[model samples]
Target: MYSLKKELLKKHYKGDNKSVEYIFNRLTDYCGKPVRYNMSEEEPDYKWDFYNSLFFVITVVSTIGYGNLAPTTSFTRIFMIFYALIGIPINGIIMVTLGEYFGKSF
Candidate 1:
């Protein structure tokens, strides 16, 4: 029972700020003490849902060039211009590094 409580406590504290707050709340019920921690939600400037971001990053690095959904604004377009200049060579280097690592591992 103690192990289970400890595990639950550990699990609760393992995520970001909101998660720590939740864990602290649950801990209060167990410990019979009023815990206080003011936690604020972290809202990302450009929120990329995990799965979508994964797909987008994979597509970018893999050089698949799927043009279905792309940048659609002046600012984003301009950013992409700079990104293309710096990113392409960096991405190529990363791909080469990964390939070498894979080759060695295999």
Candidate 2:
């Protein structure tokens, strides 16, 4: 990939030796940096398993929305709209009920 890109860059910038060299260096820098950083890459595990999926739905229902999570497919996005509409109100009711119970107890 680097060699092919370099060859294309050389042809594209045929007479401009200075700009070609500068861009070549930048390209190689990008190619090298990924190796050093790959270890820190995050796993896409959210909403993949049952427990995490439950937490993701809870986050949505409770309105702490989008903690770096989102539904990507068209159907999922549409479903989430209806889910949140129904869920948020139910969650609010549950929260108010819990608060009233605790308020009387305390």
Candidate 3:
């Protein structure tokens, strides 16, 4: 699941919608592992629907971190180094491209 999210973040940073959807659908297939909620109960708290997760990931990739969620362990922190290495510049390029697109569109 972590790898899946990493791939999605990378694809999103690169502005690849098809790759993003591919990872997202894969999440649907592997639903049991990487359980979204925190607890084992009749109804777990903070059930993240697809779009919510997407939004969370976008926030993470774009570095607009609201701090409501975060990576907890050293391993994840290490992986985040790699994630940011690729994601930061990709995100910047995408932002610039979108700004140009919108500027031309307007």
Candidate 4:
């Protein structure tokens, strides 16, 4: 088990041997462990369903965080970075528009 882990660390890891552990831990901290996510298979599409996607977007835009619904893939993670950057301002505009609409109505 240990050898396999070490072998994987060596195979995928690009850093110098002395800093492999440090790089692994640092990268894992933000990116999370893909192996663990793969092991615990939940829904076939975690955010594909309408409500699930809505919930995910709400959390991301509101800066409430994903909680347990973390992005596992590198592409999804990178996409989410852009998603949040754009979504937050869009959401803010929607909220302000609604507030003005309701205020005028009252």
Candidate with best lDDT: 2
Model 3 local distance difference test score: 0.68
- Best candidate (score: TM-score): 2
lDDT of 4 by residue, 1-106 (tens): 3454466566777767556665455546746643331223354556467888788889999999847677889999999999999999999999999999999999
* Each model's lDDT: 0.66, 0.74, 0.68, 0.72
Q: What stretches of model 4 exceed 4 Å from their correct place?
A: 1-47
Off by over 4 Å in 2: 1-36, 39-47
Off by over 4 Å in 1: 1-48
State the lDDT of candidate 1 residue by residue for 71-105, as single tens digits: 66999878866766676778899989999999999
Kindly state the number of residue pairs that clash in model 3: 0
Question: What digit string (tens of lDDT, one per residue) describes model 3 on residues 1-91?
Answer: 5565665567564566665565566666677443332223343345477977777678778989876556669998788778878887899
- Candidate no. 2 TM-score: 0.58
The predicted structure with the larger TM-score, 2 or 3, is 2
Clashing pairs in 4: none
Model 2 whole-model lDDT (C-alpha atoms): 0.74
